[model samples]
Target: MSAVVDMPGAAHLVLADGVVHLDPEPAVLEAMLEGWALQQRTRFLNWESTIRPRIALVRRLTRFTNEYPWQWDPAEVEAFFDHLRTRRPGRPLAVSTARNYQNDLRLFFDYITDTRYGWPSMCNERFGRAPVQLLHEWNTITHTSEYEGAAERRPLAYDEVQTLFDAADGRVGEIRARRRKGSLAALRDAIVLKTVYAFGLRRQEACGLDLCDLRRNPRVADYGRFGAIFVRYGKASKGGPPKRRSVLTVPEMDWIVGVLDQYVSEVRPAFMPGKHPAFWITERRDRMSLRRLNEAFETARQAADLPPELDLHSLRHSYVTHLIEFGYPEKFVQDQVGHAYASTTAIYSHVSDEYRNRLLRRSLQARHGDLWGQET
Candidate 1:
């Protein structure tokens, strides 16, 4: 059967008759990749941001095997992952990340081998062999646990949070004391860090925030325009637009009202941001770069003597845990964080032992009401 139009497996004939080529093999491989990309775009309806990395991974696999898709052996898949697992001084691949890579690889091979793709026959005709799936359950990782994140990537202790803020503020003082540059930047960082925790935000979500996103909640008129965070760039599902959610300000974290107000009224204008809509502005008067955001956290983390693993994301984790400890309902916390599942919110929560002890005490008091405040 011939390939059809507007189908994922039918891009173009790779090895057409009388087509002279200096590199026939590479041409065939590229054709396969093009077909896969079209499939992802038209059939799967994936965004470029999602498809780009998966395509890059397939090319990376080609280099690892030095063999075409038809020639790829499952053993090569095992060897490749082994190389990745123990390769060099850097940390090994995260279990979740590795599992995703494996899933991507499996899907690529599945595409080529499927009867509808016409690739199996094409490859067999060209190279006397057909492509087959390299990845299998035996060779690939699985999602066995709910929380497979790094141990260090957890909610920071209350004291650690204070120390982090102090370090960021102290940086501003030090810069001004020395008559050095970047005092304003240091000040901006201190406030931004606190804002990030006050509203449970992912990196991109935080980056996407603007002045317009600051909306007033009628219930919390005391907070005025800072009563809620309108997250226009919440994390999305596969091949979907960014999710949107409005996180209402909780009384416990309402301290962020003053911090954000001061930043907008005083500190942000100092950046000379002319008509820039971004809540976090750079010295160049544009939206803050992710690199700069990372640097801001890293500088404070180092100064506070916090663990290297406690990156900016820890602030978000700290937020979830603190909200839980502060007697917020689980559903409210889940909605505030824009988590699609309660399980995901649970994973983010790393409530302190003291909080757990309080929970246990409350539980005991509920079951034994009359025993409370009595001599045993």
Candidate 2:
């Protein structure tokens, strides 16, 4: 029989007869998880980031249900999901997130119950029963829509974007005026928010930026080194390296040129990140974490009195919307954001009311003379 995708170690290898597992059941469970991880890594080429979370989710289910895989029932799986979704009165997991949890659990079941892997026989021999797939079509969440994110997560208005940036900058001033520490860090945060909107970058894409990723555009020499941004960590396809793209600086967003120049020349060196490739550095001379990036944007959002629903990622959404409003070609906007499909880029766009009104006016003016002048 195949050894769990033909991998060795962990689940694939059995303990010797003389070996003593003080906690035998737990040991077997851990071994199963490890074996599953190894199989995913070796056969599927999944990232550790993906494998670790799936393992944790399985463990969490085991804890919540107070049972091993062999003891689990569909009722318990349904109860677990109900508890997760209703834990907070007003909030629940996004459909995508809930589906991911179900999918991971299903994948785990697929691994443990497969006859070729021998997990069923191992469990049967030790515990008088075998593992079975817990998640079924009826018990699992379904993908009903293409975009199932919260409605709150939409594009910010132009004024709201400006207000957020102003708040970020004002934070730096507040630090300086109070003779406080972190003025440099605050300044970096301010520019980072601007760069996010200017480049239409995802969180990982922005965080993964290196100093060398800044490139000159031969077509737009006026902006010099800030003419384009090389996004090395664009969102990846499953089991694939991150997609790469170069976002050219459009004239509408070219204000980032001076802002980035000031940050690189005047502010970045203060972090003392010698030889560190990360463009955004922390005070401790390490690359900034995604948490810190979110915190900075949150601070500014609250200060600006923007809606609580707005988060750092709204800036990327704002970029797509603004580009559409600015009359850029749909294909150009799609390419700039590295979306595989124009439909995906279209999903990001939430154009403002005024832009739609302008389009309506233009259409009416073409059909009749002095249409706006004779309006009631």
lDDT for position 22 in model 1: 89
What lDDT does each candidate get?
0.86, 0.88
For residue 62, what is the lDDT in candidate 2?
A: 90
TM-score for each candidate, following the candidate numbering: 0.93, 0.94
The most accurate candidate by lDDT is 2
Candidate 1 global lDDT: 0.86
What shift in Å separates residue 295 of candidate 1 from its native position after superposition?
1.8
lDDT of 1 by residue, 1-376 (tens): 6443445546244336577668878988888888788778864555556778888988887899898888888888888888888885579788888898899988888888776767777777778998888787777776789988786688889999999999999999999999999999899999988988888788888889998999999987999999998999888887677899998888888889999999989999898888889989998889987778888899999999999999999999999999999989999999999999999999999888899998898888999895886898
Candidate 2 per-residue lDDT, tens place, 145-229, comes to: 7798997889999888888999999999999999999899999999999999999999999999999999999988899999999
Clashes of 1: 0
lDDT of 2: 0.88
